[model samples]
Target: MPRRRPNGVGLEVSALGLGCMGMSQTYGVPDDRESIATIHRALERGCFFFDTAESYGPFVNEELLGRALRGRREEAVIATKFGWEYEGTRRGALNSKPEHIRRVVDECLGRLKTDRIDVLYQHRVDLEVPIEEVAGAVGELIQAGKVLHFGLSEAGAGTIARAHEVCPVALLQTEYSLWERHIEQEILPAIRERGIGLVAYSPLGRGFLTSTALPAEEYPESDYRRHDPRFQGDNFTANTAAASVVREVAARREVTPAQIALAWLLHRGEDIVPIPGTKRRVTLEENLAAVDVVLDAEDLRRLDEALPPEAVAGTRYPEAVMHMNGR
Candidate 1:
């Protein structure tokens, strides 16, 4: 695998980072043995950028990464986040207090078994706490050598500018792919103008681009897609039809639809790094192979036209939690 730096920051990682959320929860049941093996395989294959969050499993995900990177910590660039206030073991509400940010970094270090975090993201902007304070807190951590870089996830363009004024934001982690182009409207311009790198999560459209997705109701309640509007009824049918464009190109290139989808993201720009999450080594290998897939001018044009922003049917998240994004 090759390497790509998301921004001008000193933090350069694998061209394709591995999203570790699925190993802990969201996608399917926990498979510790296979998940750990996949992590090891990722390192062996030179895909060393690993993404996890403290909010994921509320803490267990960081512990799992810590366990996986015990002896090979030096080979990986670890990125974890903190954003929610917890009630015992359950998440209660959004929290980004300066004191809480400091506390979370220390706790993350303990769980990740590292001296410092490579990139620390707010996860979501806390409306109660100003972003400057949030950036200031992380900036302090950076000065104290507890964090290497500052980042924000799903933040609005204005918030990005405000936070960058307080502390240089090296990266912005958000859901971006052929299917999710909402950020391109304003966030992309803001990030580029500020020289911040982009880490695109769900570059596969939550597995819809894999050509193997089921209806929303088919997924268990534990799975996030079961609630994703794009996976429901008429939306699912229409979205699936639109995705046929990916399959057509894949078949023409003699590759998988996933490979075609990921290749297009890679061609989109050098500043963009898509962290497609998978818990299985087989799937991991398939995704990493996408780095080698080439998309010509024709392929890019067709793909760009296939899933126009208007073509995508439901909102990425449910209305209940939609308020949490782009704050």
Candidate 2:
């Protein structure tokens, strides 16, 4: 038999979902052929949910997913995000305007090769636009059979409440991990209360907690990890120390550091699902096996003490990216 279904609001996904961001951009140049193969591999392994964003590779990622899911669409659950507004020359910034939302969903459907999005998330909270307007737009898509579920990314508790009033949010995607526990204070409570599934992105702490990621200088020039404070300067040294603690626990348990990081999140909540990004088969396998590494109460407490919420040094994103979150 397969693993138990992880419930997310009204939808059900495999216990583990694949994060398709790395297959498009972020880490380095990605080979489309290899990325497609990886997506197929995930399906073969029984992973039903795949995540991609319009902002990833600036629309190129959705196209990539479209190709990968072409004839095999029914084998997976496809989730794509919108909300970034891009004019001809300039890159995209967030725009959840009702008109723009309609426009972008058409474009995303064209790129995704699908009639309806399985789960549609607003890439970020657009403060200038009312949450009700955004919810109203997605709600219309649901009624029109263009969208199955609505979601939000990095939205605060207040915005989530307001949006839920308009249309029940199916999921809330945010950066939550052992190193980054800010969501635990308010976001998790709100989500649990409202029965919204929490999709934890960057759940491996952008590979910092995985221990396989080396120094910033060792990363490729195109890699975005270089821009993260935890991967730069003295912060890298401090961050490595935190990984060392995880490594120690993993060694004793005979598991990889990546598994330890992911397993911790699994123990966090049944409603919480982690999407750890990886480009290679080896890393992907390492991540998938995390579901089997059950962490007992003692294990959870020790791991928490080893890397406390306040212990992670520096911010997860740069100043500009940081400003974009939690609106």
Candidate 3:
């Protein structure tokens, strides 16, 4: 797979990074041994960056990645987030206190079987903790040789500016796809000016863009999609309709809808690196192949016209989950 330089970060990662969230949580049950194999396969295929979060399996995903990268740690760029403090199954909260960041870095270091995190993101903007303080904490980690770079996830423009003032941000990971374009208004321009990269999560819209979303009643009760507004009632119907348009285009082009979506993101900007999640090798390879799909200006214009930002009928997350995002 061919790769491109993203700004001045000086780090070269695969065009499409693998999102490990589904291997441990969100999507469904997963085979640990198989997931590890999948990680190995991804590395063999040139995928150097792996994305995970503290909230993903609350910790399981990190441990899994740690084991998989035990000996090959130096070959991969590991990225994970901190800031969410889950008290119990029913109670979850955000905490980005400087002390909390120090503690989590120590924990992540142990769980990842590495001395330093290549990219340490503040999972989400912790409104309770000043952005300056958050950046300062990561800056200390950098000085201590515990973290190489700092990034933010789902942060607003104001928060990003404040955080960068404390420590230069190398990247900002957030939800951006054909269906989600809120970042285009402010986030993209801010990061572009600062020479920071954008790590796009859910570029496939949680499988909606791939034309595989289950019906409203088919999703498991514990499944996150069950509560997502886009997956419920009429919203899901409307969402599926838009997805069908992409499917039609893919069929006409002799490619998969998933490929079309990922390829579109690739053309969006060289600074954009999308991490599409999957637990099975079949789907993982399918997504990796997206790097080969070529799209022209006309294709992108058609996609942009068909699925405008906010074309999806409902919010990306349900109220409860939405509250936990972007702090």
Pairs clashing within candidate 1: 6-197
lDDT of 3 by residue, 143-258 (tens): 99999999899888888888988899998999988788878977899889988899999989888788687866788876778777888899988888877768877887788999
lDDT for each residue of candidate 2 in 1-327, tens digit (9 for 90 to 100): 034333445687877788999988888888888888888888888876889988888788999999989999888788899877787625666799999989889999999999989999998888889999999999999999999999999999999999999998999999988889888889889888888988899998888887677778889878888888888878888888876878887887899988998888888777888888876776777888898897777778878897887888889888877987887
* Residue 162 CA displacement from its true place in model 3, Å: 0.9
TM-scores of the candidates are 0.99, 0.96, 0.96
RMSD in Å for model 1? 0.8
Q: What lDDT is reached at residue 5 by model 2?
A: 34
**TM-score-superior candidate, 1 or 3:** 1
TM-score of 3: 0.96
Clashes of each: 1, 0, 0
lDDT score, residue 304, model 3? 85
lDDT of 3: 0.85
User: What global local distance difference test value does model 1 have?
Assistant: 0.93
Greater-TM-score candidate between 1 and 2: 1
Question: How does residue 117 of candidate 3 score in lDDT?
Answer: 94
Q: Residues 1-119, candidate 1, lDDT per residue (tens digit)?
A: 99997797767899999999999898989998899999999999999999999998879999999999998989999999999989878898889999999998999999999998999
